[model samples]
Structures are given as C-alpha cells and as structure tokens.
Target: MIKTNYHTHTTRCKHAVGSDEAYVLAAIEAGLDEIGFSDHAPWPKHPLEEHFIRMHMDEYNDYVQSVLRLKRQYANKIKIRLGLEAEYFEDRMEVLKKFIDETPLDYVVFGNHFHQLEINGRYYGRYQKTNQLLEHYEHDSIAGLKTGYYKIFAHPDLFVRSINQWDEDVANMSRRIIQCAKEMGVVLEYNLGGIRNFSHVDLAYPYDPFWDLVAEIGADVVIGVDAHDPEDFLDFDSIARAEKILEQKGINVLERLAF
Candidate 1:
C-alpha cells in the first residue's frame, strides 16, 4: 500500500521520457497519493559542454516552474513535490549546497551514480571486482548521509553491479552502508527503475544480498518508481512484486514519506 513515490524524473534529464504534466496525470490515474519530480540536478560549472544525464544550469528555472505549475494544476487529484536527484561530488558540494539553498526544492534524493563527478569519475555501476570502487562508493555514501541534505538514498546496492559474485567484502560493505543509513535515519529507496530498465542487463542492482542486510538491520525503506516515463507509474505488477518481496523479508515499506 505504498501510495507515494519521490524519485521521479522529467525529460529535462535528457534520458527520461514524457512531459512533466503527463507524469502527474499518470500518477493520478494510477492512484498515487503523492509524487515528487526529482529530475537529475545539473551541476554548475561542470567540465562537460553537454551531459545527457542531467539538465543544464540555464534550464533550472523552467524545470522548477513546470513542476510548480503541475503541482498547482493537480492539487485536487494528486500531491506533487519539487526535488532533484543529485550526487555528492566532494569538491563541488559547496556549489551544490548553494544551488539547493537558492532553489525551491522540497527535498533531494541521493543517487550515488558516479565516484564523484560524472565527467571524470568512474560510474559505480560499471566497476571492476575490486575494493577500491567499493571504498570510494562507501566513502561518498557515508559522507552524503552525514550531510543530512538527502532524504532518500536511491539504489544503495548500486555497487553490486560491478562484481559477478557477492563476497564477504561486499557483505561487509553492505553492512556499513545499511548501518549508516539506520544511524542517520535516511530512507533507502528500492528503485523500481532498476527492475524496469536494468533487470535484463548484466547489472545486479536491486540486489537481494544487499536488501537482506537492510531487512536484518531494520533500516528505513521506501520504493522509488524512478519514473523516467509517465507510464512507469502504471506498472502495478512490478510494484506489487516489489511490495510482496519487501514484506515477505519483514521489511516494512513506508506508506508515505514524512516530507
């Protein structure tokens, strides 16, 4: 009975599909009580001339206005909140903090996609079976949670995609991450986007071993549609399966985000 999702994306992210308004309509039709548009946040002064993963700094206002407009338009039908999915690049965190401070965002979800910056950093999902990547990922994750800026950690087991087999090191890494999230009281998102898009890929996210640790540790958990397209909200089959899995594991999914 999870009625809310806070990890939705908009077309501004470039890789995502559907209009902002269409997402609202789809969520309403699918019976979601609330939805948050957490499209990827564009970094200021990023080294790349063009990054397809996120919107440019210049487009920030239009993104905000569009979500705000939809929030108003769908007030009676559904609840819409404004947010951004951002990374914790240690060097550029000051800029990120400033951007968040000046914006009208309701919340921010932590997507530990890269080691640091997308331009020069390694993608966490495509790593070697080495401890270095895990070290970096663990470092970034803990540091980001310590900031208390991000409410939900999207795809916390994202590092599992790197290795072919799960081992003790991976288990210990999972424990540290799960324990940190529990200590900080941050929500760990079971991202549906992983199930929808990468289920067939070689990637191993939505990884069961990581979630088993989550269930054992009793960390806060939530399901993120991570909706790139509006129609993603209507995939009740995947949602049901995810809910049943978490529930069977004794993981109590949060029905609504306090935000």
Candidate 2:
C-alpha cells in the first residue's frame, strides 16, 4: 500500500487551502506514514505580479520554520519532510539553487508549470496552448531533471492537458522524459490532483498513454496526492485509481523515496 505523500501544499500558496497542522492531522486520520509539505517555492527576485500562485518570498523562512516545528512535534507519530514544488525558470536557477542550499529541505519536486521565455514580457503556462508549446515544456522539464536537484518529477505528462490527444510527437516526448528519468535516477509522480480536479473530463495528464510509454521505459514511479487542501490529504479514491493504473501499465510504483 502507498503509505507516504510528498506533494502536499498549504494556504501560503494562495491557490491551496488549509493550515500546516490540518494537513498533518488529516494525513494521520487517513493512515499515512509520512507527509511532506511541498508548497510552491517563491521566486524572491521575480516580479510581484508573478507571485500569483506561490507564497511571497518574504514568507519563505516562516514556511520552513512552521514545517520544521511540526516535524519535531510529530516525530514519533509520522515522518514529515520539508520540500517545495518548484518550477524551472531557465534564467533563475541560480536563485533557486541558493534557496535549496540554504534551506533544510528533504527534497524538491519539479512541477514545470511555466515554459521558459516570455511572450509579451511574461512567461506562458503549459496549459495555455496545445502541441505548439509542448517542445518548450519538454525542453524546460528535461533541463530541470538534469539539474539533479529534484527528487521527483511531478505530473510528468502534464502536457496532455493542453494537447488533449496522443500522437507521434506526444509519444516521443513521453519516451524522452521516461528515458531521462531512468538515466538521472529520479522518480516520476502519478499526481492525484488532476484526478480530483478534472475527474469529470479527460485530463491532459495522468494520461494512460503516457504511462504506457513509461512501462516500456521501465522508469521508477511514485504516487502523490498533490494535496492543495486538507480534504485532499484523504483522497483515497484517487490514490486507488492511480494504483490501478500503475498496476495495469506494469509500472514500478514505489511507496517511498530512499533519500
């Protein structure tokens, strides 16, 4: 059974809801052995307008302290890890590296929400277009994995949300990502957030076709709740669904990370 989740979030991210403690309590209630807080990492130098979905840079230290306090408090009850769901901004990697070097974090999961380069002086999100922007997504995501900074690649098939259909290009890109993860010794996440938010419709990610390629590549995989709310911490249905998919695909689903 999957006993750990490292893709949790808090209200500090602006888009997620619930306090740090609430998530822990919910995780315990749901019988999780470990829970990691991976709220969106702040880009301290990025323009204020760009901080829409993440916490402000000023709140970085406080977020760290909060999680650390909980880690100590619940040391015997459950394991807690400090982490960040980070983006790969090509020009700002040094800044991100600085944060990682200074912080006492267990891991960083790459969630390439934005493609590098600006259109109209602002970065574009992967969901904003179809196959046209897939190359950018593939390029930036691969770069982030190569950095060896991230332990898990979140939503490795997120491009499916925009592209909505599988073809030669999509299959090729999936193969490349799996191959890279295999080479880098990194694990890919089967995110449950997409299942929760887009359950009614066909999602671009958690795409079975993509995982079919993953099975062929024989890459390592893990399941993440990607919990934005405390309620999301107890989303067992989605977790079960993901497990079923992994089983069907013959993918190796790891219950926890080694490091």
Candidate 3:
C-alpha cells in the first residue's frame, strides 16, 4: 500500500480544514508512515493575492514552524516532512527559486494550476475548449519539469479537465508530458483528490488514458492523496480506486517516497 502522502495541505491554505497537528494525528490513525505538509506556496508579491487560493504571505512562516514542530513531536509515531504545492510561471522562475532556497522545505510538487500570469486570467478552476489553453498547459508543465526543482509532478494530466474528449491532440500532449517526466527523472503523481472533488463521470484528471501512456513510457509513479481536509488523509475509497487504475495500467506505484 502507499503509506506516504507528500501532497497534504493544511488550514493555512484557507480552503483546507483542520490544524497541522490534526492532519498528522489523522495520518497516524490512518497508519501512514510519512505525511508531508505541502500547503500552497505563498506569492505575496503577486498582484492576484485577492483572487489567490493559497495562504497569505504573512502566514507562510507560521505554517512552516507548525509543520517543523509536528515533525519533532511525532518523530516516534510517524515521519513528517514540510513541502509546498506550487504553480509554475515562466517569468516568475526566480521568485519560486528564491522561496524554495529560503524556505527549509523537504520538497516541492509542481502543480500547473495556471498557464501564466494574466490579469484576471482563466485558470484550471473553469473548463474551456480552446486549443491554446491546452498548448499552454503542455508547454508550462514541461517547462516546470525542466526546472528540476520539484521532485514530484502532481496531476500531470490536469489538462484533461478542460478537454472533454481524448482525441489525438490529447494523446500527443499526454505523450509529451510522459516523455518529459521520464527524461527529467521526475516522479509523476497519481492524484486521488480528483476522485473526491469531481464525480467519476465528470472527472478530468487521474484520467485512464494518461496513466496508460505512463505505463507504456515506463515512468516512475507515486500516489498522492492531495489531502486538503483532515478527513481526506484517511480517504480509503479514493486510494483504492487510484490503486485500481494504477494496477490496470500496469504502472508501478511506489509504496514509499525515497526523498
């Protein structure tokens, strides 16, 4: 079973529920060996703070300290690691690099939530049918992998959320992402959060075709709960479904993360 979840979020992210310790305690109850606190990275300088879904910049330090304290407190019960789930922007690479360098995080998972920084720009929150959006998603995702800053790539097939069908364009894009991940030596994550948020009928990610391509490419894969709520840490149904998909695809899902 996948015992380590590195994509956990906390109340600091605003959207998630429960305290940092609540997540840790729940992970322990769920029998998780390791849980990484990866709340949304703060972008204080960004102009979209009003529309941002992450924790405020002022709360960044408090988030880190809380995780660090839990790491020590739960040393005997479970392993805890501090991390961040961040979006990638080509022009803001230095800003991301500075945050990663300054913060004592164990890792950062690349979540390409937006294509670029445009005033009131459309992000993955809403679905659109434009091919340009698909291309931007592909380009930005590949660029994020090339940076080599993130150890794991979260929801590599998130572009499917906008795509209603798995056409040749979708397949080609999936191939590129899989190949890029293989070449960059990045671990691709099978996100279970999709199952919880979107119905199986409308779900765009954790898409089967994407993982089938991953199996063909022979890329390394990991399962992340993407836990935003405390109860999410113990979501067995989503985990089981994700595992079933991985099994059917013949993808190798790591039981534990090495780093």
Best candidate (score: TM-score): 1
Better of 1 and 3 by TM-score: 1
| Model 3 Cα lDDT, one tens digit per residue, 132-152 | 767778888888999998888
lDDT of 2 at 8: 95
Positional deviation of residue 156's Cα in model 3 after best superposition, in angstroms: 1.2
Regions more than 4 Å wrong, model 1: 48-50, 128-131, 201-203
Question: Which segments of candidate 3 are over 4 A away from where they belong?
Answer: 118-121, 125-129
What lDDT is obtained when candidate 2 is compared to the true structure?
0.84
Give the candidates in order of lDDT, highest first.
1, 2, 3
| Tens-digit lDDT string for candidate 2 (101-152) | 9889889998877765322222432355554566777788789899999999
Candidate 1's TM-score reads: 0.95
Per-candidate TM vs. native?
0.95, 0.94, 0.94
- Listing every candidate in turn, what is its Cα RMSD in Å to the true structure after a full C-alpha superposition? 1.7, 2.1, 1.7
Q: Which residues of candidate 2, in runs, are more than 4 Å off? A: 45-48, 117-131
Task: Give a tens-digit lDDT track for model 1, residues 1-259.
Answer: 5689998998888998888889998998888889999999888655653566899889989999999999998798899999999998888788678767998889999998886667534778886435588788899999998998898999999888787688898799889988998898889999898888777875477988788999999998999999999989999988987898898899968888886
Give the Å error, residue 93, model 1.
Answer: 0.9
Minimal lDDT window, size 10, model 3: 118-127
Global lDDT of each model? Answer: 0.86, 0.84, 0.82
What is the Cα-based lDDT of residue 29 in candidate 3? 86
